[model samples]
Target: MASTDMRDGLKCSICLSTSTDPVMLRCGHNFCRVCIDRVLDTQDESGVYSCPDCREQFQERPALMRNLALRKIMENFRHTKPHQKVIFCTYCVDSPVPAVRSCLHCEASLCEKHLRAHSKSPEHVLSDPSTSMEKRKCSVHKKILEYYCTEDAACICVSCSLAGEHQGHRVEMLDKVSEKKKEKLRNIFQKLTTKREKTKEKVRSLEERWRKAQETAAKEAERVTALCTDIRRRVDDLEKKVLSEISRQEKEESQSLSALIHQLEIKKDELSRKMRQIEELCNMTDPLTVLQEPDTGDLCDPEEEEGDKDTRGHVKPLHDGDDLDVAVISETLSTLCDVITGIRRGIYVAGSSEILMDVNTAANNVHVADNLKTAIWTRKNENRPETTKRFMCNQVMSRRGFTSGRHYWDVEGSRSGEWMVGMCYSRIDKRGRQSYIGYNHKSWSLWRYNNQYSVIHDSEVIQLPDKISSDRVRIHLDYEAGQLSFYELCDPIRHLHTFTSTFTEPLYAAIYVYESCATIFEDWLCNWP
Candidate 1:
């Protein structure tokens, strides 16, 4: 029987075989020269090499130093005897016999005959022949771990239960504790398997939604292409508008599905890891180790209330109806007709008005560009010379006002913050909330807060079903017809909301900017082909 130290010394760390052509590193670790050369080659790209044994890194691949003395010793040892390890009975002094079991209490290996005659005590913990016996004994009490302390969730020996740190705790026999833990582990494993399966199902559902959305988007694209071809040269700009809208809707839906699928996959991976850990614990042979292992925390508990709430509340499963169905075929046809009629009838306006921002009516924080077409919320007060016409709030108006003729102007606004665009009386209040477009009887405007869209007049708001897809809005007013209309410049220009009332005074192009900006386009609907 070879000694443990001699056997370990001869084994190479890399290949775990007896060292051949042994070489020593600067870190004082030895390995076969061929093994070291191969390992060093892998690190060449990093410009540094690390010792496999000590993990000590070197700036460059160190030259291999031959250990001639160690190599000579290895050769002699190999020639004298083939180094194979075997455990024998400690009591067999004259005739050595192979050991079948090792006693932890006695710290000795026993042959079959001796094992049969050995004292059957709790302390004499017998296991398959092993060199390390101290592991079976308690580190604190130096006794066999026979009891499991439930309070501490640790293994305790006889003395540990009676007098040590675990004294007076709820204790159970090791076998009983291990059996209970295994049952729990099995239950946890089953739950994890169920969760993983559910996560897989969620992934499949989202993937299916994604596939359907793509198909719907493709069909929409084809229909739009066919429509554009039919319309030909008369509506070239309309084709680009329709295609862009389709792309935007498809992107939003696909991104949502992708995010949900990613989250489900991550949850599935976590469940798999937990299941593997529980399975390993259930199959463990040592009762003490199984009982002494730390709790798996929330990983083992599948029914956590907070986790369930978060999953249900935040990670909502996308409904089958969440596909990219922006507009049905009939709706698209109707919208196309509206577009053609609006183009031929010239309902927007006969000619474009050179609309510009009124610097005098602008709020202190509102910055009107030099071109007089843009108004931005500067946050800090500009301390503009106070005047009776100046607005107290973040509001601005166009330099021109309308009293009779049909007129329209296109204005672009930020999507993030709050903004309002509409027609208001030139004499609208300049002081309080009444000065805000859409808050009083003198003004009517389409208001946008984030993605929501609505029209407000005389403090009465009516939410619009059409979402804010385009930042550009066309405000059309026919002073003689008593009609004020707002249209979103998307696809086939969608009419948002319209207000009809007799005009009592001259109306001005007005806007309210709260951490937002608005810009009037130089070329308007009158320029469209």
Candidate 2:
């Protein structure tokens, strides 16, 4: 036991093993001769050297001369167990084996056989057997790190704290500082987990809204498809009725013309037979008999003259009933019109009021409904007496016009082959073609000519893409804001165009139906009182 203690006391502080060529400084600190020499050489570049242990300053240099006595003492303990600090290799690619010694400089455990092939320089820094010696020394100061600089958050050695860059820095024990940093990292991890959960919750909410939107769109599509089907069926039935009435008139006219044709054919046959008899008589060689044959005119019966006189340019006119037998037609149209209103009211219950046609403002070619909400364009003039407010052109305005507040209404649009519907000033031209919506500056509107579309303002046309018209068109007018927006009212409304301008006059909902009806519904009128 005493021998072990004595040998351990003789170990070099630099390598923590039996020292080779041991030396003592003026401060009485001991190190291997090579170790002290290297340390002093680094400090000499700055014209300063100090004892590694006590940090005592040197003015010029330190002697590198070996201590024979200390060396002899270390030699005595070299073969003892206290000198058993050599490391064996931990093979990274092959089997594990003992290391000859750990290199403090490289921080790698070397194999026993590798020691002979290694560099012969003392700077290679062989130490006590250890694979975990990497953290034992401060990298920059090249000394055992004895403290942690809390302010700088770094591990530092005694040399660094006393004479190096961290000389005046606040420091603490390494273990205590590590614990505080670990707690901080744990708190950060917990917060990140909470944030992840919040993101997942938001995703779930968004998914639910998306699903509901899809469902609503599907239901609206189904409703519209069914309504259109019924509409087409009723229209087909009406077409058949009108055709059937025309067919009955055609049959009656055909019979009357046939009787006139038969009477003329009989008259032609009688005239042909009598003329042939007269020719035979004149061909007789007996001239006396030919001259005395009671005059070929006397051979003609008096009744024949009467028959020829009566038959000249004779034609009986056929009766073509001008009036259609519309018993079922009138009832069918009434029912269909009622169904249209029902569909409108059921489809829209918010955001707009039902609109109606204005009779006083309707043109001669328009038939305004008594309900005043529908107008069908007749190809011929209705010939009603002209009123002061009646339009002379193919256009009409609503009874109500907006000077303030927001207004929205939908028109049951016509596939009318040609039509234009939009907002116009109440005082817009009502006398000529210029009085038509979009034909003047007072109107801001979309026009559908055939299947194509365009926007018109100040009589200038902006061509738009062609699209099959939607079943309905919604007009959104912000009176105070001076905005006129049009949308194709589908399952979900799609904006087609917008007009932004300052209004100078009250704007009316003006419509033009060229060859069919365009209906607008007000909510109050559509609803039951």
Alpha carbon deviation, residue 148, candidate 1 (Å): 76
Which segments of candidate 1 are over 4 A away from where they belong? 1-353, 525-529
Candidate 1 local Cα displacement, residue 258, angstroms: 80
Clashing pairs in 1: none
TM-score of 1: 0.35
**Model 2 over residues 488-519: C-alpha lDDT tens digits?**
76645577777768998888888888876787
Worst 10 residues of 1 by lDDT: 344-353
Considering summed lDDT, which 10 consecutive residues are worst modelled in model 2?
313-322
